[model samples]
Target: MQEARYTLDDLLTLMQVLRDPQQGCPWDVAQHWDSIVPHTIEEAHEVADAIERRAFDELPGELGDLLFQIVYYAQFGREEGRFDFHDIVHVLTAKMITRHPHVFPDGHLGSRRQGVAAVDVDTSAVGQRWEARKVNERDSRAATSHLDDIPLALPALSRASKLSSRASRAGFDWPDHRGALDKIREELAELEVEIEAGHQENMNAELGDLLFAVVNLARHLEVDPEQALRGTGQRFERRFRHVEDAVRESGHPIEHTDLDTLECHWQEAKRIERGQ
Candidate 1:
């Protein structure tokens, strides 16, 4: 039997049906804004993984997963008479055009169909023109006039980095990257002092401050803190799995092994992987 092939449009239609009242899939029908939020974030991470791995074949499937997440919210919104899928698309389309003034501003010579064009800005002076435009957009939307509008739900490190970078753009910044590094060192010292005093709460707070400082340092160095941490996580997973497999092969359970033994196996895994 031949399987039914579905186009992107067909999948979108299927999502609408799955979300319909009185006849929809019970599981899909039961989901709410809060319940599906995690899936949207997960799908976004999957899309990033596909891009990083150059998984061309996997890209379509991953993107479909992301599209379904969008459709789910849209369908639910439609049922409630709040908004429809078209509104979702329309708002983002308008936003993309509006933010890219080099392409969409009056007297602009480029076609809208022509994709985003690159503008070379001095890395040292990143926040002047680009950031001023962002501040204007945010001020138009936000209740407060402050430009640092980093969402509270973003991961602590990411949120801190974004907030610090925005604040720096607004002139509330360390004089230079070296000053930022000095702040990191000071935060670290404060954490160590808290640890020595056995003040768990202070230690935790200082540790957070230290990590936040590290994020600021990453921004200063023109690196993405999220991507850097993700790469480190991937590397650790790879090395740890190698150690686990090697220990299992030697007829020993991981929990039964001492730290010294585990360290030896971990070093071996690193050597093997590095061809050292």
Candidate 2:
């Protein structure tokens, strides 16, 4: 007989066994949601990188890793008698169906372009709608009332970027990208003042404001600031490697080269990489 291929249900059942107090794997039983969090974040970034590289085949494996993290959390929940893997899937699936009204609602079928018009109204109006829906959902769940549920545990850059974007969409943003640029300049000036006054906290706050403004400008230009930063990182790595190669070809380590000379090699690297 062929060994049975594991199904999703098998995964769920395995989770239960892992959480079983009497015979469960000690390591798995000892894990908590907080302990597994870093793995989940790492898996998500790996999935993003794989997708960016167009490695479709690698996506399934990376996604499986992420799913395993989720299952691990669900197992922990089950051990605490709070919820199980099934509830996790059911809540997310239902949320997806709810958010995609055009797909889920009866007698509604059209191109995504058709939905864009409704979504492009005044930003505050859209925010109001989302907030209202969120409050209603919270009320149904546990009678919570507030629009400040955004998690504070997200990476600083990501959290700032998202908060800025949401504020922009709420119509409390710069009038245009040019306006955002001015705000960036203003923040830079304030940072200088803080520096002159030796005010570390004020300088830090101003620097953050500058970065937030830049993120806003990136959004207005339809660019992802994080992805833009990553692309520049790749470019810098390639150019720096070229400098290292040139230095090695001349029989010296890169550290031995003078700054100006190495910079020339850096430009050469850029030119060659750009096919210029």
lDDT of 1 by residue, 1-276 (tens): 999888867867898788777788999978998899889889998999999889999998899899888888887788789998889878877766655555566423344534534455344354354566667787777648453467776766678777887677668877778988999999999999999999999988999899988988888888899999988888888889988997898899999978898899889877887899
lDDT of 2: 0.79
Off by over 4 Å in 2: 1-4, 107-147, 196-199
Taking the tens digit of each residue's C-alpha lDDT, what string does model 2 give over 1-276?
999788998988888788777888898878888888888889999998999889999999999999999888887787779998889978887775555554445423332434556556567665565556665676687753242455687766667677776566557877778998898898889989999999999888888888988888888897888888888988999999888989999998788789998999999998998899
For every model shown, the clashing-pair count is 0, 0
TM-score of each: 0.81, 0.81
For candidate 1, the 10 contiguous residues with the lowest summed lDDT are 107-116
Q: Give each model's whole-structure lDDT.
A: 0.80, 0.79
Clashing pairs in 2: none
